[model samples]
Target chain A: MTTQEDIRSTTADRHGFSEVGPDDTEAYVELQQSLAFTRLRSRSRRYLVSMAALFLAVFAGIVALMSWTSEPQGGSSVAGIDLTLVLAAGLLVLPCVVTVIHLVYTRRRLDPLAEIVRAQFERSRR
Target chain B: MIFSLIILLVVSRLGRARDTCSDFYVGDRTFTSRQNGLALFGTFTMMTSFVSLSDQIAWHGRRGVLLAAGFAVSWLVTLLLVAEPLRNTGRYTLGDALSLRMRARPVRMAAGTVTLVVSFLYMTIQLVAASNLLALLLGLDGAAARPLIILTIAGLTATTVYYTGMRGTTWTQIINAALLLTAVLVLAGALLVYYRFDVARLFGEAVGGATTSGRDLSGPAPTGHRSPQPLEMSSQVLTVMVGHAVLPYLFIRFLTVPGTRDVRRSVSWAIWLITPYYLLIVLIGFGAAALVRPGGLLASPDQHSPVVALLAVELGGVPMRMFVASVVFTTIVAVTAGLALVTAASFTRDIQLNLTDRRDGGERHEVSVARRAVVVICLLLAGVAILFVDANLTFLMSLDVTMAASSIFPALLFAWFWRRFNTVGALCCLYGGVAVTLALVTFSPAVSGDPLALFPGADFAYLPWRHVGLVSIPASFLLGYLGAVVSSERNDAKYAVMQVRALTGIGAAEAVTTSPALAAADGEPGAPRSRRWLPRQRRQH
Candidate 1:
């Protein structure tokens, strides 16, 4: 039968798990549940889900518009471009703008929480 | 041929310094975000995008724009939900990340199986397409030369992977992406100039030609060739989006970056490039419809050659055609090498290492094993490509995407985000998902009944839908949740640790810093010392 030491060593070797002593496990758990880490994770998840929903809505709208409307008549023109062409181009550019905005907003919101978590982790390690 | 030889030589020379498994597999985590971004771009824009997207657009018209949009949005999903956490896991392979909070052996085995299946299917499609393109370019006819071409491409790809590994592959991908972008931009620019940059006139010409051929430029025509149903379009797009989230090759990209921030930056850069590149693809497709004679283009044996190659020929003649062909060839070579490298890495790191319990193996031994695996996998793929040379490229690719979506994506989502997910759930997700997808696809119209089915002469299909993602994707998620809820083994403590590590780069793998000063300057000495887990090269002293 494998002893406790053997099990710990095997786990460390195979899975790259650091050997966390009994004394450190409590601290590790505390650090994991600390407000900073939780806040960071929750905020990240909220932002990701909201952005995904928004993009999905845009995609659905584009598909609906394409399907519901008839092709633009020959007389319709935006500058030299056809009305249909202009609309399609606008639809295509919309998502890129949204993605950039989401990225910038997410970074601004979450970076501080991440920094706090990092500082907490450093303290726990000490 | 000379270009391939030169690239091989350059890659081999560059790989000489890759003495450790870390270096071979993840570039020792030293690549800048810009370099990784270019590699990511190359990985996403595989040969399928080069060859198949134009044909799809030519066939489907405006509906094909949805497919391109779907491709771009898939990368957005990856950037938002997956990239940062995946990098924070500090794992070299998908199996590494998934097994972090679960029972190692079983989870690793399940992930390994899924990776093998998806990568094998995806690689086979690339190889077959490459072989077909080679035969066409060389003026070879009949079934006899096809196998030879497949073997040649496979052999070349395997050699590149064996010698250069990930580091070499990354640089090669960067170069290939540059060449591919240049080729597409030139073709698109030429076409635009030909139409004098008048979008209205271009569409007008396209509609006229399409009408003459009894088709519609804007939407589905009344002719027998109807547009894809909305559900079908949605299923295809969903499969691609979810598949992008869990593909092993893409996961390997995260490991090449030093931290989560770089991972986010790298994917953002890739999106910035890929978004515009796809827009250009739409232009080129519309240009093909507008500029080429409908009957003439349709009459060509290779449907995409006129759109991709002859358009260049029309403006710059023989020299431009040669340049475009070279670009296509480089793309196929670079992508095949990258795929082979990831497959070998997964097989070695996830399967072989786990099964043998050979953690004691030194860096040299593991590197050797990876090289040997690359050779074996390439040979197997070559044989499979020869057997399935006549398979429809789109069908094969869709099968790959379906498997990825149904098996890997659900499991990865739960593994990364769900606190309640356990090993049993993961197994169910991987095995049940693969079984369900393969069964559904085998009975779907893609395999039979339809004129474009894999075996068109056979009439065994009973399933109404051609693509299986609509049912299989949701089924995998349900089964995974059921398995998790029912299992007796619950490890909330382990999940907490994993969640913390994934959210913050607390215990993620660090870059290999040889300088003691740098290691000292970085706080948390214990975390940096864990580099002992990674086998290092012996010092020359």
Candidate 2:
């Protein structure tokens, strides 16, 4: 396993932002604390937390809906299927659709923020 | 028997010379999203889902539908909470991922302990179920035949894992998924045709038939002696959803995907495949309840025999039975192989490698150690399965899921998401959560006085709830929070790096090019002509 210092130095080299020499460990620490990195961290954290909250709310809502509704039994039929069966099918499919939408939306929204952070590191190097 | 032999041969042939740790562990991280998706689907729809869901649905009516629906929700949990971040960590095992920013040795040790415990318990269930089914099919019922059947199944599972590693296992899972989906689709189609594709009539007949046997289809079905309350039903759903989020085997699936994006896509694809499969499960359960008479066709109405009976009736003749049996057999082997591989991988990569300082022995040595670990772990699990052959399988499965939810889920969630989560907190969650879960389960009614208890004669009942997830899951999170708050040690910088990597996929492990053909096409400098599979550690760090 690499030391923490080695990891930091390696990351700096990859990002094209090793303004500080490898020997200047304190300067490297300062680089990680730069405003750009701080913003990157804060934005990503906010995104993840918000996504988590949204998913939890949706999941809880589904559970509550199931609990509140009367059990599907001997119900009216649509194309020979019971109403309850259709409801269960909808419940099963809803989360899956939500997950796909969430992933696509999050990827589109967050990738650019990651790029901005990377560009900032490069700008600092120049 | 012929089908089993053929599957074993195919899997064995595919296990050709995985010379590097990356190849053995993650298939050189070369699996595309679709391939990984299929494998994930295979692992997710284990024999438990294949056999138990239909059985539960047939027995409990709407409650079984809810149970199946709850399992579908688990994939959503995996996608929303676990998959992307876990892939971003870019570690081969959960232990490696958790220990990335925390104290390495202790955290790795604790993670490895949880992995082995969960894997062993889960694998034992698969093995015992397969052996029991095999014995029943062969008309063998004596105590003497049971161990022999277990040894045979375990030996086959171990051999597959020992030789194939991840690459072979991936292909095996793909094949299993295809076979399973085909069999299910055919049976489901037959059922639909039999009912003339009338959904209301199908369910109406199911409810009618089930009610004739003194079982309620409109509400929660009787479980042994007691009907499950709404709270207990909800708890089961919660336990399954949370339990799947931290299952060690599922974590390895994320490692197989190339990047966080592919990981997310892979899980989405898995859910797409699984949602329809479970809808079919609901259909099959209802079909079984309606078509197969309660006590006429099957010896016991509640057993999985109804599914076989349904297939026998719909498809007709002995060939149908053999075909359905083959599908079930393959499900068992594929799932058990995947389980054993994860257990062995964790044992080799996390516990053995981290505990010792001799980490310099190249990829070949590590792969060798992994193969040996696979054999050792399989043998140990088989021995334990032999001892508990008569134990209630359902209770054991509930215990396994509860353990994962109460112990592993909280620890992994905090380790990845919470900034203040430290080594002390990780260990506290691991040991404390597991200890409390085991103690509660031991005294709970499920194990103490229930007829399904491991020792039914002994009476030590105290706890009211059969499942401990309602309490243990919350208690675990609290314990982790308290431990982190009290700890004086802080590693903010390391945590910062972890957070960045996990969120941005920066400094994550890259896919190594293992195929010489691809490497040549890419025009790499001084690349080896022969097969050279090496870890991308330099780039990853």
Candidate 3:
């Protein structure tokens, strides 16, 4: 199996592009020094999961509040405006919650997506 | 408050580089999608979404969805159509991406002028929004508020230049994204509490009376006028919306990321961020429908709009005020940083890179030039914004983006997908399409009319294809391919092959390449090297 670095090099050579690793970007390096952009290097799975859950909870709360609360000013948007609320609550708002949760989880899981980006950029540069 | 100040101060004191002379623009070119996307979102959450949309609800009632439609689709197009292609094609700045396939110096120059004009005009609009929001929210007068806001904006832009440079912008953007997410949710929650929200009843109330109860209600909206008044709003809305939006902000966001996937994903996330936030605005719009009416179309909603007054003038005092003020402040800060970074990047990566040839310039010199350019660009934007005040030149310039997107975007996409596409055809289609859009919006009443009126058939917006994606985009590509086919130029298989590899990550662009196309020099971190490469023989004796 080719390591990411190997993939990184082969891909870089193909595109007539230059090497750009995480260290290549001053901001990414600096931000990595900071906690915001950096991924959890050695945290227990529990911490990552909890943070993910918290993000989901907050997203859900916002969706619930919007769909459940916030009275309409007056009148139907479509032939039946009530459907919009149901849809917003069920479809729009709920999906939003789910999507956020999914995205957060996927974002965490896809930490290797960075390599993919590195790989892809390397590819594109050629 | 002190926390943020300390952060900035500490970063400034890091002894990295006072001038941000090298790293000020593109950073080290290592940004990822998550980081860059958040930053782009932060920069882009301008008066349009932050202030204007909330007020739009109060102004148009449910009709505001027209604006939402315009905003969402544009972003969608950005994500799906342009993002990866741009990433594959560009390095450094938006202007660089734009001028890549075209060799005509005049074209590059035009693209630069457009970028500068659009960036300043757009930045100015946000500034005005900042000043107005401060006065209305903080109870300051226009005289007191305007200068204070400008100074703060200038200072923030300056400090951004001083620190991690473009990298600083990404960090600031993350902060902004966090703040914005919190603010919009809290406000949404607050509105819910106010209405005691009965999902079905509220809709009933709106349909029955609230939306059109008064003489000012534009006749009975509750009457279920199924077919929008069909005012031919499609084109007009498309024109102004495209005109005012679509340029500097996204292009600026480009420099923050590592590559195309980030451009696509981050932009996609931005759509999610924006859509939900605007849904909150819809929450606010409905909030306004029940609470107040907005006067004057396109007027400063922070004051003139009743939503602002109610949210402030009415109940739930200190917490609301604190939250709103904090959000607005963060919004201003994040947006300012993003704008400053991109402006600097455009100068270095695009204009400077091409003008001086990036290959020979000193990293220190390039960074210094970018830093100075940052100051000048920020000042110029502020001045232009102040001069225009309410003109909303951003709306006009945004038209260029859509024009670029629909016309140029399609051709560029074809260049990626179709091996047959030649540069000559792409240029004709790109330039022709751009010219058509400019003519329609500037010379036609489409610019004058509202794009969000009643119907698409009667769209008065200046853009050639208002809402229908079916026709405008394809025609553009056809024009491009036909132009290329008619000309004697070769298909640039080499360029196409390289682009394919670049996008697929088969090659990392950051790696130094032998391609004459990449003019950025190497060695010594944070040092710009373009000017140093300016053939020494050409220099005056």
Candidate 4:
């Protein structure tokens, strides 16, 4: 039986490609362990956690308010709509607003670190 | 209808595909962020957005808003977490990214089978929906008309995929998105004009109408509802969010761009487009609830609601209704074309080429196989659609989404971020997660013992919830972690290389041979390897 590795090697040889050499592997390990890569990973984890928390809090808030508060308090209304309903709808659109902000922030904050990692990879090629 | 059909044919023809796997699978990595973004928007906003969602809101106001919110937030989760790394890692399918770490045929086979299952389910739903709409439009009824419409749609979908491949599909989807957005905007504007441009008036009337019908506009659904329970609402939201991120058809769109930056741009464009689209959907849903009444155009008395079409008729007239219906028809066909293309690519690349160890030189045979696969898959989908023509297939769609969230989502999460994940863990996650989700759903209320169940006469519902993802998703993550730790196999060095490549996107967009060429630093010392292996250097070769 032909294993997948054998098949990959045969295909690689036929396509004039060499597998990753030890030198390249070493460089990859070094880059993976570097300070910039570490910082990037930490920052990514922070961003992921914060975004999840934000979404869950808003989503849970909407569900609780919608389920528990069946009738509006004091018969008050936001623009002739129930305050809870308006709040639910507004909360639903909040993530979209936050997404735009997050995208801009991600590009601003993360791009430089990504560039630093790229420069490190460049230096390793020497 | 005739005009829309002509436009679809022209759009598919404009794709002008080349006979290479790269061109067929990822559009030769040539699409700009704007083009791919529009295509992503089109691919995602399926029949649910156009027909079923508004219908839900017309009937069940609170639930509809939640579902729409789930969809909007899900795309953000995808953009922030999955899009950039997935674009940097995979070439053609989800299998490529997973196989990079596993290096096994079983892993690819499992991924391919899941992709086939998910896409097949989604495709059948779209076909059944479009045929139902077409049947209503032509005033055709009965079983014969349904099958005939299914066959017509299946034929058109296959033809589009055969001619356009990915490039044509993308072009077709871009047109579909533009047309859909315009139709929806016009409908919403018409509704607004009817309400004298008062957003508050629209909301007040919608609430009044729903309240008059004994349904609260700001509370939980009925306890005996066929949907998921109120307690499990958060899980349902999470399921949609996670499932949307890893949908096989939408997932493949990430790899159709040239680099990491384009991937980010593509998703950003999709975010801006999709956010506004969902907002309009909210307005349209409420408009349907406020304006439409019993025995209206939504009087099809079918499971799928042509609520948007009904609202159009009420707001504008017959001609506007036809225009909106045509746009929905085109949207369905475009989405089915995309699903068919993805399933074919998965079959050709993951199963036939990788699993069977096929060694065709130059991949010409692979392209041929993909084209053939499209016809076979569409035929099979048509048969399945006919079988479930009268059944309520929302359960199947829910199951499909759960399967995606439970299986692919966990596997990709672990493989990308977790360092100790190995071949065993991946296989276990793929096969085990799918099996658990299937078993749970089979025994859950979704399959039996409820009004909307596949077998309402049967009573074997061991689980109370309609969506099994609440349990299966967390179980999948745990299975992956335990599978990784239980086995002693580890590939730290390979993980290092993959991690580097995934983060920086150094050698992601090239043929396999070019990757090693970029790493060639052994012989020459005149210049740095990165400079020597730049695009200018590669072109000189």
Q: Which scores better on lDDT, 2 or 3?
A: 2
Worst 10 residues of 1 chain B by lDDT: B532-541
Residue range B288-331, candidate 3, lDDT tens digits:
55544323222332233436445543445766765676667767
Q: Which candidate leads the pack in TM-score?
A: 1
Candidate 3: deviation at residue B535, Å?
A: 34
Ranking by TM-score: 1, 4, 2, 3
Q: What tens-digit string does per-residue lDDT give for candidate 2 at B1-541?
A: 6756876767655545467777678876777788889999988897777777888887776777777877888887788778877887746887777776666778778888888998998998877776666565555788788798777767877787787688667776877889889878988888888878887788889888877877766565454565556677777878888897778888898888666777877888898899899999888888888887766434653343445445455555566666776777777777878888898888877788776665677678778888988888878877988997766676778888988898888887887778788889988898888888899889977886767676778889787777778888999899988998999756655565666657666556777656565544423243222222222222442
- After superposing candidate 1, which stretches have Cα over 4 Å from the reference? A1-25, A72-77, A80-84, B142-145, B220-227, B301-306, B514-541
Ranking by DockQ: 1, 4, 2, 3
Ranking by lDDT: 4, 1, 2, 3
iRMS (Å) per candidate? 6.0, 6.5, 12.9, 5.9
DockQ of 3: 0.06
Reference-based lDDT, residue B478, model 2 = 91
Residue B251 CA error for candidate 4 (Å)? Answer: 0.8
Q: Hey, what RMSD does candidate 2 come out at? A: 5.2
Candidate with top DockQ is 1
What residue pairs are clashing in model 1? Answer: none
